[model samples]
Target: MGDPIKKIELKDGTTRYRFVIDIGRDPATGKRRQLTKTYDTKKEARAEYAKVKHQTDEGMFVGPDKTTVSAWLDTWLKSTTVDVEKATAANYADALLPVRERLGGKRLQDVTEEDVDELVSWMLTSGRKRGGKVGSGLSVRSVQLTLGRFRSSLNVAMRRRLVVRNVAQYTQIPREARRKAAAMAALRVPWSETEVRQFLASIRGHRLHAPVLLALIGMRPAEVCGLRWSAVDLDAGTLSVELTRTLVEGEVEEKGPKSEKGKRKLPLPKPLHAALRAFKARQATEAIRAGELYERSGFVLVDELGVAWKTDRFRRAIHKLMEQAKVRKVRPYDARHACLTYLATSGVPDVIVSAWAGHADLSFTKRVYIHPNVEHLRQAADQLDELLG
Candidate 1:
């Protein structure tokens, strides 16, 4: 009675829309029901209307509303019950918050594939700091992740009957090719025995020195920081990696080692063993004097205040040490790669090396090991012949 209903064909061949007359009683409220129903095509809309009219006569109808994509995303982010980790949720929120301007006003039900394409294209063409720098394009990787999250949000909306279709499902992101590493080694800067010595020489008497050396040997920073006195076996010349220290909101927090694989005993070289013994003696003397609980979590590493050292602070210290030593700066984690390369070229068995390093696969070790020096290869070949004989 208000206005005549009409069907409209969308540019996309697969769908059609219509504002149909509402004529049915609301099953729960006993009030009259009224609204629109969309269909796959114009022909299908007529069939759908016929079916809906019959259903309405018999009693079954629901109303649709004008919701925007950005509006629904906001609701989904705040209310969805997905079991995402804290760090992951923080990342999603950060990524989604800035894109509101791009999507906020667009009608969710009327969203087209072109809208998704244009938004992503604009993100990439725009700079790194989201409207900060003109020339710095967004990282392809971050853009890809943002798009994936968008798709996930849309999927939730579709499930709740908030959106008609998941338009983001069909969107695509262009790929960027891999880049090369500029380090001495592909993924590391394998310090020669001499370089290690020089590094130690520079950091002597420095608070973080011994732990840095221990890191170079094989232990991850977290594993080393988490080490407790109980985990140390001074006489046995080994250290048990039990806990890892992480920085949370600028404070050191101790947590169990990241994985079971991370909780292993590693034999310390003679120099490291001696250093730990010396470190213990010094720490014991200080603990007695300070009357403060000497952070006995036997961390092979700790800050000046006898508190656990954080991984990032430790990394920054390592870089500073590099600067002082005049060595090219390499990440502390690269020391793991350096150690693996040293073992591979030293004739250690691949399987044995894998277990020692807690690597899940031997192929991963092989792929990352440094290229052997020509002379070392010849030496290995000669040794192989002697062993074969």
Candidate 2:
């Protein structure tokens, strides 16, 4: 019931109006807390005062909070896990680590565009968390991911009234960083078809050939590792991709496909089907040889004793096979890239290629997975010549 409006005279003899409202008790000290608003005109002062009072009375008040960026990141992560898979949540945490390390102590509301921009620049220069030459920054892709995740968290903060705007809204990855990323990707192109055939020949009788072929045939390394014998139907010559055992924090964890489209049944290519049959027979013999010691984990990719392979192990196996085959090594995931590229260029329909890659977006599959080479371009030129000539 105290006086809510007061008039103040400034040193220049100008008058200003202010409204003061008592919010509620601060639980920490059991003291009354008041909110104040000042405006040049009495009308503006009255409007804000009425708004605050209504918000306070209606339990819609969002007062100043001092939640630090680091603390709120933790809260946001918990909220994130509810909406995304655990592996995705872990990836988000990895992306936000730079924010936590550099700006975590700052109040979330105080984060500015300059702060995020500087962080991005620093990440491009010195953000490598581990294992790089001194003064070398993280990769452009990693910095982009960090900035994106921070922007997302800030969006949540704005919705919760913790901040007025996303500080990272206008931030951008440096041009040099993007160019560098593009150049690096160009240098590390996936294996060509000749290399693919050579690698398969080299691994023909190898113990891990079946699993590596699964990767070469467009299955993700995690999917290859997670695939179970029960999910394969040799009689039907089809394989179901419904489960994935991916790594989170260096530990293997099982989960379902990332999306509904990802949970598809792909017809097994003939070579893959034959490889699987041979591998299955070999595993049966191994199980008999190991007797009670066999793990019988039901996974298709296993060791002599039936112990299943994880992504890292499967990746290493693929690399060793590549080296032995005299083929250049690429990341295991690139096998999927090569497969998709081959599928796209071999006259496979774009929609079919997208579905084969387990992606709902045809554009994404085309943009990211399908890489056209000079020979492909030459073929297009030949067709154009035929049309024009």
What are the lDDT scores of the predictions, listed in order? Answer: 0.69, 0.88
Model 1 global lDDT (CA atoms, 0 to 1): 0.69
**Candidate 2 lDDT by residue in tens digits, 143-238:** 888988888888898777677688899998878779989999888888889888988888898888788888888988888988999999999999
Query: Could you tell me how far off, in angstroms, the CA of residue 231 lies in candidate 2 after the best superposition?
Result: 1.7
**Model 2 misplaced stretches (Cα beyond 4 Å):** 1-20, 23-32, 36-63, 131-135
Per-residue lDDT tens digits for candidate 1, residues 1-389, read 44333656566744455756676555347986576666655676677777767655754332454777677777788775367544445678767653565787877777778888887787777736643675565656666778888889888876655555778898777543123112323445466656767878888777565677788777777777677778889989888777777665456667665457666788888878877888877777777766765554445566544776678878888898899988767778878767777787788898877767766667877876544655557887899999999
- The deviation in Å at residue 112 for candidate 2 is 2.6
Which residue runs does candidate 1 get wrong by more than 4 Å? 1-34, 37-85, 88-138, 155-197, 248-253, 288-298, 361-389
Weakest 10 consecutive residues, lDDT, candidate 2?
127-136
